[model samples]
Target: MSLAVNASTFDQCLTSIRALPDGTDGIVDNHGNPVNISSNATAISYGLCKEVCGRDSGAFEWSVFSQQFSAWLLPWLALISQLPFGAKHRSDNVMSMLLTVGSPVLGAYSLALTVLNSQWIARRFSGFKYPNVGLAVRALSSLQQVPLEVSAEYGVLASMVVLPENNEWWTELVEGLDYIHTWSISAASSIAWVVIAYLFTVIDSFANVSENIQANGQGVGSVWLWLLPIVIGWLQVSPKCDFDRVAQALEKANRKAYLADYPNPVPLSHKTGRPAFVLQHYRRGSVHRDEESSAPIFNYARFFPWVHAVEQVAEAFERASENALSHVPVGRDVPWAPSDVGVHGDNRKGTLDDVQARPRRGSPIGRWGSDVWTRVIVASALALSLQWGTTGAAFMIVWFTPTKGLGCRSGAYLLYGLISTLVWLIMLLSSIFAHYSHLPHPNSQHLHLRGVVDETAARLSVALRRIGKFVATLNAVWIVVICLFQFSSFFDRCYCDSSVIGLGKRAFYTLLLTEEDIPVLRGAWIGGTLFYYLFDFVRTI
Candidate 1:
């Protein structure tokens, strides 16, 4: 197959494209061929081009040159271009909000959470399944399962490129301060994204991305391990095809019908809704973000990782309750019933699912270091819990919940009360469910000895210990709620700062918060939450 290029067309259009700023991303690594317009109805089309640029860097060089050149014309625009369209000046808007996570020192942490949250939701709701498969294949499938969108990544990076810190205002913004923390945070965030964007663009992360090299389709997932090699190989070559007569053949086609024979239709400024100046972004045309595989669809699902994290925390609390209830001694007249669930599966530890509960033999307790002191500790904890609920007892014996000042947020300790009451009810109900399902009481050999109250207490204990798992399983709603609030930029109502190091006395609910004398509460929350999840994820793996 022959590809065509017209030297005069590129020479004529170079200045117009070079003067473009906003459209730089679409053309960064764009590739397309020269095709003469019929009746001026045809338009210039560009795509993710590789071979036609002579070398990989050639495309990158052209993209950067045009970008730098546009920067030089910061005080200029509305240029006339070869493809016949005037460039409309574009500026920052909500598109810039994708990178709005900057400003707090926790920029990278928030970014990582955003990415992980996006991945977790994609995994949870995905209809696509990886069947019972080989380990290597399953792992690879898992890798592919978590797709990162290049388009989204591109949008974020493009914003960072034009962010305030990268321009002249950066100096004035940092003028008097010996060290500008927020500016530094913004700079760091932009730098990190610059690397991410380069990889996303240069490596071609978009899935099933018009593998025909110069065609159109939609999908976004990638095997960067493989693309890395391809990029490296392409970087070493300068491609030149012997297609001298291809442009001549196209030039001779006067009838538009002849152009329809080609599978790849040329995209003109009119064909695409964008202005010609926007089209001038990449190699005399523009490239578009593909949407396929459901992952790239932007929505609230992107913040789901935090939901998963909170659910896990809730589950942990439930497990603590379960363990405490299990140790409580039965009454004097209540005959001790064995919990050995009539001999279930082999007592293998790691082989069992973390959430799955099996009956345990009630013998040899002292051998495992459960002596008088342990019993005393348990009894004391139960007393305190009965009086003050788990949160207070938890505070007395242990250092209490790691989420500091959580209790202070509510009126008269009402928040902890709400949390405890909810958890207690959840545990009691879940324990009851497990009793019905697992029949925690081993088939009572004393057939007539089954007492209703005794059996009820045993089942309730089991449920209390295991209620956390149920909370986690159905935690989708809470997760979505927290995510909406965490990154929410539109939270107009403000409140007092109950955060660990909240500003003077007030705090906003959303993470994109800025205040003097206090760290961004939401930023720190997101960052800390993300860090906990990272370790948790690692432990899980």
Candidate 2:
């Protein structure tokens, strides 16, 4: 138990260490070489870990931001859900389903919108930025407001009103589809979380919910929590009818613009001898090319200089080849010849010389046309709403029904929603900050982007500053508001007498819930949401 002193003894030990078995010392193969496997195992393990878990973990983390907003908003949603806004309508199946289903969809849509509008505002102008929250919300409201431009001229009109061909209903249905496309990523994500929570409960159920209940270990709810969202989502099946109609109208508008650009495009060749037609806009050509002069001319002397130089090169090559190939004693069949292989390359440039140019195509209308920004803002709003809605559902499931088997699963879906929302939010916030930081000061600070566009492109210098200021202000405000709401919600849930803990203590205790783990759970919720948003922000670019 004591120390052994003396350098002599230590020296002897060191000597023994150096005198290891010959094979062990060198670790040489038959040829006697050193082997270093230190990095090999490390590399392998790192690769394995990345293959098995890294992707999912990264994905989970990225999903957190969208959830964060949801986390903040869930308490409000729960309170709203519990409110007696519709006593008479509560029992109505459609109303019940909408509140249950549509609410979350809307939340997710809002989250998506927040992100997208922010991004758009960021990308559209050089400076003077804002969060576009007002814009996002307005866009969401716009789906209801933007009149369905359906006409009886389109067959869709027939489908909107009367039963199978009900155009009016179809129009509304299209509006709803637009709504879903805008927001449902988060909604679906929340449902996915519910599935996970349900699975966790299912696993715990194997041990005994009753015993666990006695031990306050009651499992969460069934995985079927996910099923409800999916089922409810199915009601949106008819929404495509609306999308098809809208898309068709937009397409028609594009075609009209295209055709207007080329009323007759007839050939008007003069001494210049330029042809004005191209393959892309080819019609049954009213103007024809002169067949006699169509043949292209080539300069054999300049182009085939390589062919002329080949004889000199061949002499050297032939000597080398004969020396190399002849060295291989040919007792066999035919030997290889130079002419057996001929090289070819596309060196032809003659066609371009006399080629006549056609008129340039009209300016591109982009993937979407004039209403592109408006559509984008609306879409983003929908995404944000859906994300929020899902988070709300998850929070309710976990907070109110912590004993239910699907709470964790709900949490999982909430996590996914959080991620999607976060990405959107970050891009938005970046754009806003960029806009505001670059805003013009003093006399020009209040000037809008319109003025900047109209006055001079140079005015954008100030506009950029405003945009940056807008973004920074927006991000700061959003973060602060979110924190306030979150804290408020937590305080309400924790301190209130009618809180989940107070009223449901018996059930909570039965499920073995611990007050100590509350912080951890909340942290997980917020962290996950944040992680997701940050990741998605990166992805949006």
lDDT by residue for model 1 over 211-325, one digit each (tens)? 2111100000010011121112212221111112212221222111101002222222123222100100112110111000111111111122223222332232233223323
What's the number of clashes in each of the models?
9, 110
lDDT scores of the candidates, listed in order: 0.23, 0.28
- What lDDT does candidate 1 reach at residue 170? 20
Q: To one decimal, what is the Cα RMSD in angstroms of model 2 from the true structure?
A: 32.0
Q: How do all models score by TM-score?
A: 0.19, 0.22
Angstrom error of the Cα, residue 33, model 2: value is 84
- lDDT tens readout by residue for model 2, 1-541: 1111112212333233234443332222111233243211111111222232222211122222344333333322332222111112222222322322322332233333333433443343222111122332222222221122222221111111111111222233333334333235555564455445444443443333222121111111211122233233333321221323333433332221100012221112211222111111112211111001101000100111111122222222233233333431111222433322221111100111111121112232222223334644665554454444334444443443322222223344344445434444443333333323333344565467545543443233234323433443343244334333332232112122112233332211111233443344444434433443443354344
